[model samples]
Target chain A: MMQMADRIKLKVLDPGLLTTVQDSGRWGYQAFGVSPGGVMDEYAAELTNLLVGNPPDAALLEITLKGPTLRFEEEGWVALGGADCGATLDGKPVPNWSAFYGRAGSTLILGFVREGCRAYLTCAGGFDVPLVMGSRSTYLRAKIGGFQGRPLQEGDVLEGINLVEARDEPGKIVESIRPERDSDLPLTQSSTITLPPSLIPRYGSPILLRVLLGPQEDMFEPEGVETFFNSPYRISHEADRMGYRLEGPKINHRGKADIVSDALAKGAIQVPGHGMPIVMMADHQTTGGYPKLGTVILADQYLLAQGKPGDEVLFFPCTEEEAIVAWKERRDHLSLVRAYVDRLWRKYA
Target chain B: MSVSENPSVRFLAMGEACVVVEFGNTIDPEVNERVHRLARCLQNLLSRPEATTYQGTFYRQEYRSWSEVARAGIRELVPTYRSLAVYFDPLEVKRQALEAQITQLLQEIDVPEPAGALEAEAGSQREKTFPRQGKTVIIPVCYGGEYGPDLAFVAQHTGLSEEEVVKIHTSRTYRVYMLGFLPGFPYLGGMDERIATPRLETPRTRIPAGSVGIAGTQTGFYPMESPGGWRIIGRTPIKAFDPFSDTPFLLFPGDFVQFKSIGEGEYRKIEESGGRP
Candidate 1:
């Protein structure tokens, strides 16, 4: 158990629309019908953790469209990534994908999202929460894990495990990014380090998601497959962490719509008897009965996660080799950013 | 029978990370057994360092690196009725290499025929031939009245008495095909066709946990309270899933379950005693 003194505290002034503590995901227990609930956008979550120098799997608060208003009880490094939620610290604008130091008693307000659906808020030491089934992610349906197994509410006090010592050295490194700025406070005052513009993902309209034809592609007709790729689908209002119900051209099946329920992989586009496709997301059930037409590639799942309700989505077919190449490219880009951050830390601290 | 004749196996890509090994399309016990056998084999091979040889065939030295990465990459193995979905990290292990390894394993490994198949052919004496039969679990259920709201409906629909419905339901042991829909919810097979009833026209907003129900040829119980369309027949005191417990799930795929009819009094007693029926 960590000592109370070694933890930094944050009080929830106003809980966002849907905010929960999330890590990588809950694995191993899917066989027992457990859903691997986690942050919607893995890319952004990883970047936020990397920005704050937290462990890769460290838990962070995943804020939805409307962001949270939190008061820093102690001084610590914080990073906001994914969606541009118009974050402000002490009434001053704070840039996304940037690591910044927060002074004690400073209020951080994240307003309505202007770019993407979800935003990630990561601190230097990560959120201090008990691990349920080897994860800190909140599975709302089961009411297990996360902060009391539910969304954060007003008056909730969250503790962050203080892994990094708040010495003047690391603070000075953060201040070096904007040394030209004139400030009333001393040299140890708050400063920000932003990620390169090239590395920052652009959230655009009519999101084109690359998909690989499935484990059950034979279940669908050729015309149905054509219809799936040709037509555009709108993310229905029923969308959530479980899945996105797409309202678009009906994907016709050759025979019966139901198959013997099988393991539902993430990003599986299951078209039921009604002919509408429902793309399974982070909190999808372990197994399902509907026939899957295709699965969105691993690299594009984060792009799909950033899409909000009523967002236009177009599916484009890609080969397995193409999917692997796309995944490798994403990995290479992240590695570059990681190396760059490590160099900065090594040089200054 | 030697069981050497291979079933129709297809390696399917469920994106870059997962590979679905489908044994066959139907929900046959033999196919399901193969699925579980393969799952167990992969789990042992991946987790144990010393498990180099499976069924006497030693894996080649060239595939050593692949196995090493597979140990870390292979995140989850989900076994359904006739398929095993292997979720691996694509960055760590390539899908092509993983598929090749699994294909080689399938050819080398020998899965036994289902115990039921052998028993039907050679009578009860041949039960000792197979030692890997799934353990049978007995679940006590309080049928009719408030416990089973649809008991009278089922009785009328099936043209049988309510007592007959209960008797038929408890007669044959059912095999757990898979756990899905909800945590610890068992999708049981081998329900009597006579008692097969259609799902409700309107699904109940809240079906109490432990409420057993029948839908078409399927019969299962709700592990947790949620809105469902299955016809409610009875309620059980025992919890199918307890998140906080060491053994979170009460049932797993390939397990056998037998429903025992009990009175409402016994249900209350078990309910009071922490559902130890």
Candidate 2:
């Protein structure tokens, strides 16, 4: 049981490269042309929330290559997942893929990311942001959802739900029911634990992405389609939350490289008249006019989202069945991770 | 006017999670209506309590509601001018089962005849208007001056007077074909060819929200401040997108829009009232 508090605030000391509140995504509004803005790395976001004992879609801060410096105004458990940015708490190093309790007035700082570009910082009870279109993810262009519908800036204060932090006393029986604490009292003890190395994602450059052949495969010449699969494309500097523009071999279209603008999937590889591919991301428009040659499977989008500018990407065609099987395997692995985390919490508590 | 009643339709894989039901190769209002019809049919099917559960698992987990259940399995249906993209959860519903269900629903759908073709058969070239189900929103615009920086350019390109440009733009009631690009941004149809203008060579970095612009044969108002290449001729005072409201978007795919000219004073008044006008 958790005591109710009006606000558990996180004062933003430094709003790094780009810090925005994100969840799984905003759904059911794409038909109305709302962009499905959310966390770039779904695996990391969900894992971060899981470690914090929060719902998979609970809102968390999405820290980009450079992470933000935040100070907790209240005692709460926090977890960092995805890219390892060498996060430090009160001058002490904090490990990724783990959950740690932060005392009130403690400062958390994140340095330059070493490998992956994006990471998620999740609080115990999730960020208490208004749910716009069933999500807390920020869509900057529309100025909707998340913390004021924008990225965190200096002087911004984010409020988190006041939930009871798990504190385990030595040799005490594990209680199934957690007792509610007074709202004015702070959590006495905090425990830290990290997932096994095998569970953590390892990022490497020139990432190989599995793509499913398209809704417009016939629109491209066979050689063009072959070129797309065989060649490596470098992500250009034009990459952002909306999409990534890749510089690669010309994928010459059989006809015009345009279509009646249609619904766009999250990882749609769209080629406009210029013959280069643009991989759609979390903040992609609901529909686009460019002919999409293929789509990076939803399960594999985390790989694309982690790739930074100038990172090389090689695509391989995959069947829809294979993609589904991969997704199911990933989902099963996630369930296993959640169970393992719960068991660890029980052992420590 | 010899358009086939049975158009070539295909169920193409958008990805593992989505399947696009494409009706035609080109844009057509008839195809759009069919897309919407299929979407509606699917919506009606998913809303049923029986359809709420999949493979013995309840779609609604917590705070179970009709809307929550409807979001399970098949999550969203994004209808475009020529196709309907159905995004589903492969974990809940298998692709084959979902495809079969959609095929069954497609068979149940009554494909409406092309309204334009029917009108042509009646010996008239007039546009056949569908039964207006939604209210027609009249957006007041302040054309020319600071609000419309490209009004002179548009008039010169169209070889018409500045006033003629405004008159021609407002004369016809445009059908909202679809919403895309940005939130609440409507892809409108029925812009007169006489006033069709080319997009700017260099797109502006920031076109304010409510900017009425012309690009090729299309005319639409920006629902948010965004960079665009369209030639802006005016600006509207209406809040086309309100993300906080129950109905966040002020317009829909089937809605009708008419732009009415207003002076700068009236525009200020409407702006002050927060789109009350």
Candidate 3:
């Protein structure tokens, strides 16, 4: 375990909405019924960690819907990422994606965001938190992680280490910084894949996430499958971290519903007796009942996660190879981006 | 390329980090059996010297370079589930050999149930082979007070007096069907048919922890404060679980729980004394 320096007793004074500490996530224990819990927005969480010089997967505080009033007992640097929560520090404005040099005994207050549900606060050297299993992410339902696996409320102290020399400005890494920042926002998410055109999905946009039929996919009739791909569905208000309930024309399996309980996946769109398909999410249980018509590709989970209720989402059938090809292309593009960013940082300077 | 009976079993790449070979679509015994077996097979297929295997044989492989082994490395066992997802960092896990190695293992292990028995007998035989950690704790409950405003209502539904309701409730042993919906909340099974009830039309936003409730042929304890619709007959002083503690839950899958009768005054003493079950 790594001990962080300059530990600050973060008295919440008040925890607004849901304030919990998070990290990349916990994996490899779903058989025990443990949800792979962590930061809902992993891309933002990692970026914030890297900005503060912590390894990308380091643990951080995830402020939900609203932020908390935090008072630092010691001075340190913290990077705020994910959601544009109208953030301001000490009654003045603090920018997102930039590190703030906070002084000792100062109060940091955060407010609500118009677009996203969560905002990440990454301390200088990551939070000095013990990990359960092989991760440090907070599993709220199991109540095991993040300042003891519970939401931060009034009078909670969050601790972290200072391993990085505080950064000066955005630095020469400014190459494409504006575009990168814009991409991180809600508006710029292209309906089409953003990588090299050659790496583009064979399917047409709006992308219909094709799953190579689930084991239970046969339970549904052929028309059920056809309606699934052609028809449009709206996300319901009953959605949360666990899963999203789609509201639309109730899907039918041989014109009947009520499937024998079966296995399910996050993104497995289940057509319950109501015929309305419920798409499972990160916090979905290890097993489930209901006929799962299809699943969203693992690659497009982030896209699905960002979508709010009432957004119209359509499904397009895809081959298993197409899904694998998309994943390989994504990884390759990510590497290219990382390399380009690193070289630009040095060359421009 | 092949399909099996477990309908929802599919490989879902959570992200860049890991892949899950999930089994089942619901809380049925057959689905659960396949899920556990697949998990166990994965543990055996991906054997690493550094991994620390725990009870139930859950193992975590520690790789200095996660990306290499992660590629095709995770598809070690096709074990009768729907499918298994493969995830790894291609930039980090540069070796093509890792994927081939796991694919080789996948083909070698086809009999699915390493614990023994054939694929068809997953439900009945698998549980006997696997050793599940079980606990039996007697919880002291005070019924039919303000803590249990619905106690009389439950009695009326079951066509029994409040006193008789207590007697019947205390007599049977309840199996914790599962621990879900909330942390440590017990989804119990095996309630007497006479006492079965449907949930309320409207749900209470905040049901206190330890609120013993009856809903649809099952009696459960609300291990945490959450919205609920069960008919609450009483409350218990037991903490039920504390995640910070080593053993997070006071109960487990095969645990047997009994409710001992108590009164408001006795309940107060137990609460003030801080006695644990």
* Candidate with best TM-score: 1
Across B121-234, the per-residue lDDT of candidate 1 in tens digits comes to: 532322222224567899999998898999999999999999999999999999988787788888899999999999999999999999999999889899889899998999
Candidate 2 regions exceeding 4 Å error are A1-7, A164-191, B1-7, B47-71, B111-135, B263-269
**lDDT tens per residue, model 2, A1-349:** 3234334578999999999999889988888898778899999888888886777887899999999999988656678999999999889788888877666798999888989899899876688899887888998878888889889999998887644343332101112223245332112334445777899777768888999988888899999999999999999999999999999899999998788888899999999989999999999999999899999987788998999999999999988788989999889998888877777666655
Q: Show pairs that collide, candidate 1.
A: none
TM-scores for all candidates: the values are 0.87, 0.86, 0.66
**Residue B166: error of model 2 in Å?**
2.8
- Using Cα atoms, each model's DockQ against the true complex is 0.63, 0.60, 0.11
Output the lDDT of residue A95, model 1: 85
Cα lDDT tens digits, model 3, A177-292, are 22224344222333211122342222112324455466456678787788777888887898877788877776778744654333345667777888788877767765565667
Interface RMSD of each: 1.1, 1.1, 6.5
Over A1-349, each residue of candidate 1 has an lDDT whose tens digit, in order, gives 2222335578999999999999999888887789988888889998887775666688999998999999989766678899999999889888888877666798999999998799999876679888887889999998888999999999998887645453233333432332223352222344335776788887856889999998778888999999999999998998899999989999899899999878998899999999988999999999999899899998999988898889999999998889989999988988778777756554534
Model 1 CA deviation exceeding 4 Å by range = A1-6, A162-191, A346-349, B1-7, B49-69, B111-131, B263-277
Across B150-187, the per-residue lDDT of candidate 2 in tens digits comes to 99999999899999999999999987767887888898
Greater-TM-score candidate between 2 and 3: 2
Q: What's model 1's TM-score?
A: 0.87
TM match of model 2 to true structure: 0.86
Q: Identify the CAPRI category of the predicted complex in candidate 1.
A: medium
Model 3 C-alpha lDDT per residue in residues B1-87, reported as the tens digit of each score: 222233444444332323445554444545444443434444533564222222222122322233235434453221222333344
